[model samples]
Target chain A: MLVIVVFVLVGIVTALLWASLDAFGGNVEQTAGVYSTIIFFVLLVGTLVTPAVSGGAINGDRDAGTLATTQVTLATTGQIVLAKFLAAWTVALTFLAASLPAMLFTVLAGGVRLDTLAASLGVLVLELGVVAAVGVGLSGVIARPLFSVVTTYLVVAALSIGTLIAFTLGGLAVQTERTQTYIGIDFSVGGEFDPVTGLPEEIVCLEPETYSYPVPRFDLVWGILAANPYIVLADAAPTTFTSEGYPEDLFGQIALGVRSAQLPIVFDEVIDECGAALAGDPNSAYEFETPQEIFDRTVPSWFVGLAIHLVLAIAALAAAVARTRTPAGRLPTGSRVA
Target chain B: MTSTAAIAVEGVARSFGDVHAVRQADFEAASGQVTALIGPNGSGKTTLLLMLATLLQPDAGTIRIAGHDPVADPRAVRRVMGWMPDVLGSWAALTVRGALETTGRLYELGPADARTRANELIELVGLETLADQPARVLSRGQKQRLSLARALVHRPSVLLLDEPASGLDPAARVDLRVLVRRLAAEGCAVVVSSHVLAELDEMADTAVYLDHGATASAERIERSRATARDWRVRALDPAALAAALEAESIVTSGTDHLGALVTVSGEAEAAAVLERLVRAGIAVSAFGPAVGDLEHTYLDLARGEVAEQPVIDSTEAPR
Candidate 1:
């Protein structure tokens, strides 16, 4: 059943990519977009399917009466737990292997860089392994298979979507007031229009207008987004930029969103249109930074998120090993060892 | 502990929170002998077996399988002990052969040796016809056999079987008895726990009685053995048999369609009663103890009718 689900999801993504490639003639940027999109979807499907595949590995064996038999053998508790984790990880990797054709096609289209491919695939494999380890570990620690499976799903959901929700709510909960001042030029007083400057040679400025409103301080809570798996994947991949210093693919685009969030909102701003007109420099009133500049200026947080995930996986497995060691001293209430 | 004893348990007690599953179990099973662990429901037979199997630890007391502590050195104990739990569990996805082969491998057998051992066990347990079939397809009896075969994979010197004959047919039960005896004869110490006393009577050389998580003391077992028990006496003429028993001053407990039951003190009394019946010109058809030895002792212990006596030597009761 898991294999079928993986194949169907990969097939749908492949068909969608193929259709898009036909509609818009495939270019280097488009092919790169296709590869990034494929990797993202594959990661999505892998996380969704991994819990059901790996959960209930140990407790289910106990329920079926096979665990005690294995326990009585020469195999130690550590060996048994490690073997289950490895088996579940292998099963999860098979899902990644299922989408190999689509990934290969995108690579052949001449867009994906060698570094981007290596980093994304490596992180994808590790993320899948993390999920598998947690699932199998929870199975041994929890007494019932059903509860373990649900708990595994909750863990995955917490890392995938919970962080995003928390970041948004945290940012919204802390609001700040911002003031804006705007000075307008009076066209009624202009004598003659300058051909080069599109503004009157003589200008009369109106009274400066000032307004203030509350704004969400996203900069204060943007660190919470660093814990999200999607954010980690995006931030870890190498970004590609266009000639205009804009992101070209989905990874760069998502990374740009997170990187741009790091900048603090300007509370005081001034728009002196009359002053600029007086100086004959109408374009000098605005300041802009491209996505590429944001990407370069912000700190990358994928390694931190990956480290946190690795620690969680290891802690879960270690707890399971401690609980499962025998000769078992204390069994969970209402649980049978055999 | 005797040098020949492969399993020596002393004051073994295990509890699950509020429930004391095995309070004070003490017994020794010698190699080359079949020891029957006889008990009624909730007697902690399975708990004791688990401790011996090295799957559980005793809260107080020590268990030695082949002279190695199960709790402290389970690896050594496991290397010499094979346990078949009362609950039958198999790998549903694996074939019978595959399950056995995997068990052998888990015991640290080489790949080729594991395969050979699996085939040999399949034939030994009469599972040749279903050897290649998935374990999920097996009936309760077939699964029982597979579990037994898996236990024997490593050919340990000591074997622990919990309710081994529950789901077996009469023929299969007979085969099981023969196989168990053969294993014992091969110098393997076998401890079989079961409620089927008559079956154990024909197979086990000695019996251990457990009641309320404790083994019956030696004096208690001896007293139970000394109590008078019923003997079935059948003759060609029921009237003549009753008259002959009356003349011989033997009290008849009851009379059924098959025969008249008379309580006898021991084997000598039973023989005297039969001799007197024959001297009275009555033809005896069948005459023997109404229940197996283990059943009588078990019933006596369950009834709490054991006489208070001084502790005697801990020799086994007459089978």
Candidate 2:
């Protein structure tokens, strides 16, 4: 709850501060949109802290000498493991449930549709559950509470958000580029670049038919860019992100939700000679194509978030349960060590 | 023969890497009788108890609770057996009561039954006041009592106690002794292992003395009790009972050689011999029945000539 309040309140207050200072010519609506992005920050911090704090609960109990009493009795290992897993998973669920208001705030600002919100939350729950399970399994292997927590979190992060994330994005990159070529995105792009370099040294304007070295940043370019999937998904949520991807691409799409790495470029702006085109947008002259499929393809953010959270919670619970299922004599507790 | 040994352990053996914890050990705790498993520190008394409890499967030989095989059908054997380990190990947060209650619940007692058993055994072990305290707060004595309560909570007919007197003060030791006596009286087969030999002298009907992981000796419940040997004494001088016994003669020499200060090692029918002495005109001061002090006799028997130790070749089949 404290984490939720801190992140959400700061988002609102920072946006209000920007509006008050007239940072973007006193655009209140734009400031509201920026402030409402609090949902992302809440999940980001939650992902890191959840796995750190309660991840070592089973190992902690073993260290505390409680496991031995259970082991020597009629209590089987399964019962022991289930009990520990539930206790840790409950903490993760509590944090997610308590922070509901902040999630709603993003919806009110129109940045997240109801479906996107639900899907995002669903993914968050699953991802975080997997993290928790990984932590628990590591706890059994390590036998020390502190080491379990550190190693589980590191391993979970590496698998879920580290290397796998980069691979997922790179795969999504090929997927989106292929989809755009067939979906009339080629008409808007005007001439292809080297498939290897992808560093388009110069880009041609869609409306003016003029070639330029630096791409003019604009709302259309920022929202519809092929490189940043989150931006393309947000504007063309229900369609663009889904149209060209395989059925299994749902996994890559979910990973994209937790990744904030792509958003910087989406929000970065280049002062174009033509009254500062929107971030990464090439020009203002081209007619922006607003497809309804965009909103349709945007998987619900809440569901995505919920999935991540669920995965993490389940994984932690499973690992904890497995640890508990081990024979008392075999458990990591110092007692019955032989 | 005995009606049916409640616990029959025949040549049970267990080993760790290089250590022989239990070997060629044959022991039995008969129904409605208390058997004392007395041994030294590494004598394997507790290991034999564990086999009776079915907590350990023997590396060789067989053990049973009543007629149930302890190794092959442990669950059935378990229902009839209660085991109290030596160290209760409650130097943690959970209290004696909590540990006992949790243990009871694990055996699948109904909630109400578990609670009732927990409370009953708590009071039984004299830990009613400390029920809610964490285990870590308990003293060593309190922990052992709680562990005993936990073991007895299931009302098992066969109870295997590994050093039940451990961590107990003198008064508590006496109390525990009385409790074990009562349990045996109630027809529960009990095998109590203890380093304190004297406590088992009065409490145990049978004594199975273990030495170096094997049965050094097995004495019947009655024989182990050692009712004193009867003796007839006739002093040559009136009021000379002490001096006459101390005088260096065949009787005194025999007693001294056997480490017995007073020469009293024959059976009750020595009255005939006394009559012969009286007929010979020897003045008799007093003639009375004498019973051996088992504790003292045990100490003497333990000293040397262990050549008298019983050796049972080919232990009978378990159960």
Candidate 3:
């Protein structure tokens, strides 16, 4: 049922994007956008459903009085835990599989790159597994099924939305003052018309105006965004750039947000419009780095986030194994073996 | 020391934090015999069985099942030990046969063997009618039978049944008793813990009485067994029976709806009292101990009268 829901939702989103992009004259950018959107929805649904499926794996059995019966069998505690984790992982993956047709439709439209596809799908699968593992692990560690299921949801929420909130607040908490000096072009005093330069032949400059304002130091807190699962997926995918050096799709767009955060705020900036006008080029003063350049220069944080997630998953399962082992040394409060 | 003893516990103790669930439990159950773990509620009977089943570790002292220490080598013990917990839990999503088959596979049986074993257990437990139905549809008694069948999937040599007869119907209870006896007769060591002393009285060959997390010492058990208990006497005429009892100077404890209750010291005294009632020209219809043997001893022990009595010579006492 969950798989069917995933397929329908993903298919609808894909179809909507396809129709809209086609109306706007479909291209590689539209196809890439479609692919990224579908993958994102799949990840969202996968994380949301995994906790419900896996969160009661162990403690529920204990409550129902079946845990000890299995414990008495030849299967060890580790095997039982691992089996549950695997089962949950497989179940979670079926949600991904359900979105495959939509992803394939986008792929057939000719925009999603091979490396981007491989990396995003791989990370998405692993991320889903991480959630499943955490759910099963928490189930074993906690005494009650309801509490464990809720705890698993909280963990997912912490990783998904909490990181974003932290990044925003942390960046804002430490503000830096930035000074801007603007040298305006005195259009009233300039003499007429040089069509080639797109500026007046004689230009008069006004006194430079200086202003200081506070800017949030996002560079100091950008690492927090790296912990977010969506950001990890965005940052890890190989981004493609348009001919003018702009991001072509949603992944690059989100990746650009985090990557640009890595660049420190310039304390002083000068807008020399009058100087540029006098030098016969009016727009040269506003030439800035493109999104592609910023992306290329910033550090990739996806692997770090993925590693942290893996460690968290392993730790939860390990704790569960310790707690669920029979000939159990000690039991959680108010829990019974059988 | 019976070298053939399938279960041996020496000073076994276990506690849940401040609540000592089992303390200083000591007993041995030999193969080919049914040992009843007799106790009242909160008496640690289930806790002791958990230790023997390899699901719990003793806090102090040792437990050996089939010559293997459950604490040190639970796997070996589990290979031969089957436990039916007092809590009847089943895989609600699976059918009765599927649960048994899954349990057999968990015990390391191959797929074909598991299927065969599941079929045999379904028949043995008399759940053939409900074999294809999901466990969630089962009543408490049917679930109990499924749990028993699962425990027997691996053909364990030592069986530990905790309150196995609690939810059983009378006919099912008789089948369970017969099946348990047959298992013991086939050289399996069976330890049954239950609140139903009368059922145990009919099925158990010997009993280990536990009270307050401790097993009654053998000497204490003997003393309790020999303590004087009430006997019920029913005659054709209630007046004649009461007169005969008074005429014989037999102390009548009380009278119930059935007949007159007299306190008899032992089997010899009970027999003598019956003979006198018959000789008094009163047709005695019922003449027997008021309670089963295990119930009498259990009651005596529970009432703390076992320690006050000196050992009595009850050579002819019916066990």
Q: Write the per-residue lDDT of candidate 1 for residues A1-338, one digit (tens) a residue.
A: 67777777777887788677768774878888888898899889889888887899999998889999999999999999999999999999999998888798889978899989998899899999999999999999999999999999999999989988888888899999999998888887779888877787788898999999999888998888787777788888999899999887888998887888788799998988888877877567766788988877788988989998899999989988988888888887877778
What order do you get sorting by lDDT, best first? 3, 1, 2
Which residue runs of candidate 2 sit more than 4 Å off their true CA positions?
A: A1-69, A91-154, A157-338, B1-3, B47-54, B70-72, B90-100, B132-135, B217-319
Residue A188, model 3: lDDT of 75
TM-score per candidate, chains pooled: 0.94, 0.59, 0.95
On DockQ, the stronger of 1 and 3 is 1
Best by TM-score: 3
Candidate 3 lDDT, A202-311, residue by residue in tens:
78898999999999999999999888899999999998999989888888999899899999777999999999877767688786899988987889999999999999
Screening candidate 3 with a backbone cut-off below 3 angstroms (N, C-alpha, C), the clashing residue pairs are none
Candidate 1 TM-score on chain B? 0.94
lDDT of 1 at B92: 94
DockQ of each: 0.48, 0.15, 0.47
- Point out the worst 10-residue segment of candidate 3 chain B by lDDT: B310-319
For candidate 2, write residues B58-146 as lDDT tens digits.
78887777888866766677677787777465436556666666677878788788888888888888877788888667788887887
How far residue A257's Cα lies from its native spot in candidate 1, in Å, is: 2.4
How far residue B53's Cα lies from its native spot in candidate 1, in Å, is: 1.4
Q: What is the lDDT of every predicted structure here? A: 0.89, 0.56, 0.90
